[model samples]
Target: MQIKDRINAFINLGKFLSEIDTESNPILNKAEAENGWFTQDNINFALNSWAKALSEENIKQWLSNYNLETTAQRSKIVAIIMAGNVPLVGFHDFLSVLITGNKALVKLSSNDKTLLPYLANHLISIEPKFKNLIEFTEGRLQNFDAVIATGSNNTARYFDYYFGKYPNIIRKNRNSVAVLTGNETEDELTKLANDIFRYFGLGCRNVSKIYIPENYNFEAFFKAMFSWKEIINNNKYINNYDYNKAVYLMDSFPLLDNEFMLLKEDNGFSSPISVVFYEKYTSLESLKKNLKESELHIQCIVSKAGIPNEVPFGKAQNPELWDYADGVDTVDFLLKLP
Candidate 1:
């Protein structure tokens, strides 16, 4: 199939997603029933984000960054081991493989078993050629030329041992962080709440940590976070909030609580659900050095502190097509495959 054929198939798929009534959609209902974390609002937000991204204009602009051959090339079967922490977490990798004219051997995450395959079947309907290019296997993946796997730091070691010989992109646990200068307006802080509470802080793109200036008061920050107070209504989220709070109290760990979320001072990046770890920074120069040394553990930075490559407030989860994860160019990896 031609590149245009693949692009057109995605564009059509985007239209289908955009037109659906997610509030009353049966598929979405089933997904939510299967995984309590996959709430209807969150799933709708994901679908909307993807629909906006797959526009012809957006696709063309993203492709402009690379030299793509128009005609079909020899296709490689790229095995994708997906992570299901959030809805459609593996869709980007799936898109990269197929859009680059490679066959995808996808292994779905048990937490997100239904959504992608349903969409894959739709893509096949849009461009029947995709029927041969897309696949899902419950058994061991075999005869694939390359691999792209996403998991925790532990699973990454296993992936390395098994797929080390192939050309691959294996991603491990990484968390996002925010740097606060304490000069941010209430509006900016409100937007920052979206980065914190979206998807109930499960996705890697969620801001699990923050660096604040010494003696900074959090009155305004907590006020802004009030916008997402309804998040506590979700049973799973509230359970985590209550449990983490009880454990911290029992252990004599000091914490700041606002009835919905907790903030604790720590030097860690991967915070637990309903808790955001924080560290007080003395200077931007020293903080920059620390972040540089720990770049491998960071997925993205959200700040207005003049940090290079920092994502703007509230936009961490709304990544564009070219915002490659872990700063790796997946399309480039697939294109150079032998």
Candidate 2:
């Protein structure tokens, strides 16, 4: 299929996604049945984000930013090993391989087995040409010329050892962080809460940790976070909160609790569900040095602190098409595939 046709197919798929209502949509019901983690709210959020990203104007603007005219027109089969952390987490990589005039051999994660295939069927129904361009595998992946895999640090090593022979983009564990100046408005902090609570903090783009000025008061932060107090109503989340809090208390670790989530002073980037890690920074310059030293572990930064390339507060989940994971350009990697 031609590039324009592929783009149009995705745009139509986005329109279809926008119309899905979990209460009434059979597709969504099937997906939820297949994976209990794929809650209705989370599935709808993923669809809305994808719809916005796949709009005609957005797609054109994103493609315009790249020079695809010189890309070699040969076709290659690109294997995609998707992560099931969040709904449709691997769709972007799937779209990239197909949009760049390559075939996709996708291996779906067991935790997320239903949604993407349903969308793929929709794409083929929109334009039958897609039938030849997309395929899913349940067994060993073979006959693929290149690969794109997403997993934890341990699984990434296996991908490196096996797929290292092929052109590949293998992503390991990474988490997002926010730098707070302790002067943000309640509105901004409210938005930051969305970044944290959305998807139940499973996405890499979720703000798992925050950096605040030393001696920062917790009153305003706790008040702003109260907007999401309803999250405790979720049984799964409450279980995590209860378990993690008990573990911290047993160890006599200092914690800030609001009955819904726990906050602890930790220097790490990845935080457990229903918990957020925080660190105190003395100066912006020193924080910059620390961030630079651990850039690889960070997926994105949410801040209004004038930090370079920092994603604005509350917009971490709404990544643009160019916001490649692990700072690796998937499109450029596909374009250069030999």
Candidate 3:
């Protein structure tokens, strides 16, 4: 199919998914009953991003960034081993593969097995030519023209060993951050709260931690965030938070708290499960050095400064159209490969 035809198909698909009962599907429904997960909202988030990615200006810009042609000239085969920290975590990779006119062999995560199949069906329905391009499988993948794999730190080593030997882009576990200059507006803090709390803070894109100016006032941050206390009070999220809080407190670990804040210093690349950690930075210079020292562990960057210039910050879980993990344009490269 033509580029315009494919792009229109995805836009139409988004309009369709906006109203469907995501929980009606067995794969998606399980996450909801089991964890009170908001699958529909997660699906909607991806669909929104899909629509954005398909926009003519945005698509053209993204392709130009990747040094890719927009006339759908490539026809390579791509095997995408998608990570599923949250629902539709693999959607970006799928979009990259589809829009670039490559065969995509996608392997879905057990945690989020529903949305991929549903979207795959929808794509085929929208552009039947894509019917031959998208396939969901659990089987061993080929060396293929290119392979894009996203997984944990441990599993990433395995992906590196196997796929690294080939023309592949294998992503390891990465985290986002929020840099607080102590000048953040309430609305900015509120948006940061969404970055932290959405998807119950399960996605790697979730801002698992923060970097604030040393001795900055967190009182304002808490005041702004707790305004959406209903989200903080969510059972799914509170369970993770409370459980981690109890463990840290029981261990006699020191932390600051009011009703909605957890403040502490951590040495690990990430905090314990369900907990958000913070480290102090005296200046942006030191922050840059810290990121340089921690380069292998960082992911997307979020800030009020439009697109990020550093490795990562506050926009941990919600990635925009161009925010591929590991700072690589794996999809565009895959499709462009000769």
Candidate 1 lDDT over 202-278, as tens digits, reads 99999999999999999999999999999999999999999999999999999999999999999989999999999
Output the TM-score of candidate 3. 0.86
Tens-digit per-residue lDDT, 1-338, candidate 3: 67667666776776666555554666566654543565456655655555555556665566565544443665777888888777777787888887777788888777667667877887788788888888888788864777888888899899888877667778777877666778778787877887876766667767777787778888888886675567555666667668778888999999876555466677555665456788887778767777777767776556653333643334455455676777787555765576
Candidate 1, backbone clash total = 0
TM-score, one value per model: 0.99, 0.97, 0.86
Model 1 CA deviation exceeding 4 Å by range: none
1 or 2: which has the higher lDDT? 1
Clashes of each: 0, 0, 10
Regarding lDDT, does 2 or 3 come out ahead?
A: 2
**What is the per-residue lDDT of model 2 for residues 1-338, given as tens digits with 9 covering 90 to 100?**
66788889989988887776657888888877787668888899899999889899888887886766544368899999999999999999999988888899999999898889988998999999889889999999999999999999999999999999999999999999999998999999999999898988999999999999989998888899999998888888889999999999999999999999899999988999999999999999999999989999999999999887899888999999988898898998988887
Instruction: Write down the worst ten-residue block by lDDT for model 2.
Output: 64-73
Error of 1 at 287 (Å): 0.9
**TM-score, prediction 1:** 0.99
Pick the TM-score winner.
1
* Whole-model Cα lDDT of every candidate shown, in order: 0.94, 0.90, 0.70
lDDT of 1 at 110: 95
Model 1 deviation from the true structure expressed as Cα RMSD, one decimal place: 0.9
